[model samples]
Target: MTEQEQQTEELRCIGCGSIIQTEDPNGLGYTPKSALEKGKETGELYCQRCFRLRHYNEIAPVSLTDDDFLRLLNQIRDANALIVYVVDVFDFNGSLIPGLHRFVGDNPVLLVGNKEDLLPRSLRRPKLTDWIRQQANIAGLRPIDTVLVSAKKNHQIDHLLDVIEKYRHNRDVYVVGVTNVGKSTLINQIIKQRTGVKELITTSRFPGTTLDKIEIPLDDGHVLVDTPGIIHQEQMAHVLSPKDLKIVAPQKEIKPKTYQLNDGQTLFLGGVARFDYLHGERAGMVAYFDNNLPIHRTKLNNADNFYAKHLGDLLTPPTSDEKNEFPPLERYEFHITEKSDIVFEGLGWITVPAKTTVAAWVPKGVGALVRRAMI
Candidate 1:
């Protein structure tokens, strides 16, 4: 075996279960040389992320490539398990794993939409679940059932457990999701409810926190496996700093801001996304995003110069320091024949009227698309 592989084979992190390596600080299961030596002597080892989380309540972001995640999925395809696929209700598109249906083989899928509490209370639960089910169907997944719950708020978790029990069919359960969809938090909630342990897994706003599979024993000699979150590179979480992520990810229910715009007006969602009314009557557009995120209005004519001049100053979260490194916004034009929401994946959406032509701009790697209005 290669030297690094041999070293890794010798020691695994007690916390996350990744094989230990001291070579690359940013790599999975990385420990400092001194820490490695100490861990070897003591037989008590935690990777840097787990160590930081345990000692300082801090989270350090780590990422694995698409190939690595695909390998994990391939392993799941061979297992006789019930796949519990969790998605963020607010970021349904971003939470989708490409080819997930194919990867799950003949195993049943239970779709769980998390962050339900982030949506306005005016939206009914039945409607939300219906929407989630429809979206999943379109994505080629036929979930046995769809459940919406807010893992952070501890809402509907018990119902979710009961549902899992009904459909799991005495098989092992595998929970899978894209990074930052609150999968870790949901698993932690399950652990707490079952074993009375709190925060057993590291949960963080930063993406890709869980680097290895964590298996929890079930009473029926089965295991509930919490798999590593698959990284979606198109997400805003990949582009922003941890501080900026905190500013962008909504923490509570979003109180949408409505704007009445003429054909020539524009809206800027901080420096992260831009919306222009290229053609349409003066109409109302409602923005659903983090309540703390800044929204600025300006004439369409001045939009370009305004973004160039004030991106870091008036427009923030590519805040002053992040602006230089931030990817340039790429334009997407949409002709809206029906009432639709212009979604900037992982950022938020703006609901616009029917018979309108609009344009959206987001960071180059991020996605911007139009979908039927949710509310």
Candidate 2:
């Protein structure tokens, strides 16, 4: 090929699928010029972001506008593909892609709930899957099947592959999810299981790690596509710094903490969320959060002043520097007619009993809602 032709030839990142470039380190698919020559010789290439993520366990922020994601969805809508929709079991509501059913056209969706290991072991699989199915239906999606797996722990990964294999039927597969839902990790697990390659795609705790679609060819000449995670602005992850994200996002199975409270009491989940027991008889409230996160209790009347006083010191997680920039918590009140969980999206949840009236507070623009108790 001519030198100009070689220079103009597009080379895509094997990890993220962005066009490889040596210019503009801040831009997508950037790698050093020396690394480009090395990649050419090695016949294996990754962009700088994925390279750092794989080797150093470091993450860099990348932007993907809604229009870009929409264009991707349009491509999926036009393709003959099986849509494998992944969602964080902990942040189900926040992980949903808005109007996804409308975007998938006639593609069959296989709903996979990731981070299942984060839930208490006592929680029944059937019940959890039922809850997920119900939630999917509510979102106007009738998934062919629902599977629960923990990509981090490599739990139920073989079963997930089997289900995908059964449903894919020689067509291409497209895995999709909102940011921080473990989609990349799940894809990495699949790559290891299928091809025996480790960490083929970048996986990190941060949001928006995968900036473009990565296609992995199957033996049948079809491919499995890993799409960039859609940004959900309402997620609490968007508000917190990386340090606080580690505190909010649980790493292991949650140990439920039960508190006996009277009508006028409050529980602070770090400085990130609040649970107020507003009315009804004294009862036990169960909290499900990261084991390391501190929960502080105080009288409901004194909750406001207490939060203001101890926010950075005792309550923590908006750390000291973050507290000043942290958005104010917005209140969401619910009268619990039955057993339910008041979820502070991206943060953890509190299980409240029937006949209790409670209020949940999360940062403004973050989602807080009630769902049937999972445990």
Best candidate according to TM-score: 2
**On a 0 to 100 scale, what is the lDDT of residue 371 in model 2?**
89
What's the residue-level lDDT of 51 in candidate 2?
89
Evaluate all candidate structures by whole-model CA lDDT and list the values in order. 0.90, 0.90
lDDT of 1: 0.90
lDDT of 2 at 368: 96
Candidate 2 Cα outliers beyond 4 Å, as residue runs: 1-9
TM-score, candidate 1, is: 0.93
Which parts of model 1 are misplaced by more than 4 Å?
1-15, 21-27, 32-45, 54-63
lDDT of 1 by residue, 1-375 (tens): 777668667687766667788888888888997998898888777788788977886877566677877788788899999999999999999999998977899999999999999999999999989988988888899999999999999999999999999999899999999999999999989999999988778787777777778789999999999898999988999888878888889999999989999999999999999999999999999999999899999999999999999988899978898899999999999999999989999999999999999999999999988988888
TM-score per prediction, in order, is 0.93, 0.96
